[model samples]
Target: MFPSSRLRRQRKAISFPAGWQIIPIAGKYWTSGAADGLGGWRWTGNLEANFDDFTKWGVGQPDSDMVKQRVALNFQSLAAVFWESEDDTMSMRYICEVEDSGTPTSPQPTVTTTTPTTTTPTTTPPPVNECNARKALFIVLESSSHVGSANFQLGKQFAADLSRAFTGLSTSKLGFLTYALIYHVRVHLHNSDSPEEIVSDILSAAYEGHSTRNTAEGMLAAKLQLETYSSGNPMHMVVLTNGVSASPSTTKHIADLANLVGIRTYAIGVSMPDSADQELLNIAGQYSDRVFKTDWARLDTILGSVVNKVCNS
Candidate 1:
């Protein structure tokens, strides 16, 4: 059994396949299967094989579903899992290829922007000094049909919790955006009045669902609304999705826009399979310095951690 005291720490450090190498929806140690179940492939090498053999040498049976099917094996103590298959004489050759993790050591830092337009200095803006400068935190809840109820509920809970926590801070503003069949980015309030109002707004947003899930359109709308409502205040985005974009180019363009606007994005994957838009999520998170994964049970904790990271940073 895993150590009880260290479970949380271990979970935070758990390593998974990510990066450009896994881009275009492919990985070196990837597995491919078909409906016929006759033609399949597992890619790995001697180094990975040896590591897997050594790690699983005396461990009776791995507890993971992927490991039980022999689709993955822990190659090292560094939380790296090697992809492989169980059948040896099925005429399915497991190819080996060199690969890297591709994830950055730390989250990407926030970027600043420069505009070409210039204006003559009149008053110099008084140095913009304010110890209690408020920041606007906009959460776009995609009630699109593409997103499941479980994801929507989790997003609502996260937004409520964040609003509550920030309400206590003197220099924080919390806002809510809910997208329905059409993109509707609603700002519950400009600046928070109380935690109860914030919670109510989140619940009301969840009650409304959009026709389809168009994250790109929703993100663009949210950016525009934030620009109009918050003005000079900083804005951060937290997007939750299970599947990949129907349009890859659109997703890339939105990611670029977020990066350009200094909007920190935290992408949350809820009940999404490893094969579903993992690369896009990683890229989005890489650009915004906030990518995470969790199911319903642990989503609240994940949101709490994310808020702390972004607010403190």
Candidate 2:
């Protein structure tokens, strides 16, 4: 059967020759979304080399609206570019350069040489430790009608102990925010400054009573002071309340603030029971690594422990 017709199946595949190379579209800023549509374009080895070259190109001038986007090697030496396919892909291109020999009277010889150097990426370290690091301590003193001067003295002593423990650590700063019936917050610069002066200033501030303790306002003030003074340094707050507030919502607000700002709240109950709702303490401990409970007898020890943990950590 040399049949009327013969049928043969053929498959065609596109491939590049041995020395043939892919030349990525030049200067076509492709966006990330459109990079996928680019077909048959392959990225060769050592992409960083291309990145270095692009970064050296620098940025363009702004428009009439004074708005401009710049391209440069960041601190990490990472490069960013938009591709032509409107695709933003981390890619670069290659160009083959040819040298021409002009009007050779005699026979001209061509020399080809290739030297590959091993490139080790350079890394930058973080900023050096500064002498101005500050730690904040929010002391909330809440005393009931039955509370005596001795209990207030105990609060002052606890604050003093805390100050002493943290003072030795860094040449930084310390800030005090006291909230009871009213708000009392102050920033203390401890760099070459005396702790006694700071304590005296704290003690001299007038005390205001609102007939109801605003623990929430106290915590908010703490957070605000931490943001204003500490500059994101670690904060430790000690709340000395003998009784629960007449306004329960304020306590809840305090808890929410502590949760939000990651401030450690250590609650000191003078004669109050531990079974009482310690939302502030719980929230503080959740943000920080330590939580403490103390009565009149073990007050100093508890304060010391909290200070040590905060400063050392």
Candidate 3:
């Protein structure tokens, strides 16, 4: 498998090894870094990897049975190199990327491969949650009229629930913001107060109830907040909404910018329409697992899952 954690929080790119097209097109080598997440296949590290691009997938690839075949590989040939579904247990070559700090202030990706070695098996430790690993999270709640009073309450509860979940994680930094016609930062990532404080702030804040859904503007504001109050940890953004923006393409453009800076974004939809779900998917880097959907009545059900992801992913 690929070194799953090396690019976990970095802005980097990965290209095929030089002359990779010559590699065996079949039964030769593939990478296991792409795995089946709860909802769909996801790259092990760096959500910014662009695995969501449909053009990168080979014909009939990823297969129909996403459950049993939990891993994916690359199929290389004279014509193309693309991804294909494979069994997780398969032995294969894996690719890894690292940042070349000497290149420039901007991130430059360089590939490095580790030769597989056989070693005596040992007890593998449990995965560390992101909260314990010093990660920063910013929650963006939609307060536009499109969300309505009922859904707005649910969004508040959702933020409050997350705050409670991350309250005692000493190393984690938390922030909260709301967007509609205007953007408001309820909490800063650098706030010395505990995450629990965010719960109160979120609940007490007034809803904007504006007609415009300035999702892109809110996202830009979030990027500024993270840059200004950076905890120097892996940063994540979660956007909760119940309606599509008037300009979803603008929101997607901002999302691409955020991803370029190593800010992984998750989109949660509350009883949103199909168009809004598509908008959320675009915001979530086109990954299904990163876009969670639920009605206001069942919003609480996904709170725990989102908390776990914020804590561990």
Q: Could you say which candidate leads in TM-score? A: 3
Ordering by TM-score: 3, 1, 2
Q: Hey, what RMSD does candidate 1 come out at?
A: 21.5
Q: Please report, as a residue range, the 10-residue window in candidate 3 with the lowest summed lDDT.
A: 119-128
Please write out the lDDT profile of model 2 over residues 1-313, one tens digit for every residue. Answer: 0011110111122234567675533253321110001111111111111222221222431111111111212121224432222111134332221223332233348899956433221132122232233566556565434345455555655665566545544544566655554344543332344766555555444344335455554555555445445556676666666666545554555555664666666666566665654554543544434555567655665654565565555
> Which whole-number lDDT from 0 to 100 does residue 160 have in model 2?
52
Candidate 2, residue 144: Cα displacement in angstroms equals 5.1
Clashes of each: 4, 15, 1
The Cα local distance difference test for each model comes to 0.50, 0.44, 0.66
Alpha-carbon runs more than 4 Å astray in model 2? 1-134, 143-146, 169-171, 186-193, 205-210, 280-289
Per-residue lDDT tens digits of candidate 3, residues 63-139?
Answer: 76532233444544646656666543356665434444533343359999966533221133122222455667889
TM-score result, candidate 2: 0.48
Candidate 1: which pairs clash? 44-96, 180-210, 181-210, 181-211
Candidate 1: C-alpha lDDT: 0.50
Better of 2 and 3 by TM-score: 3
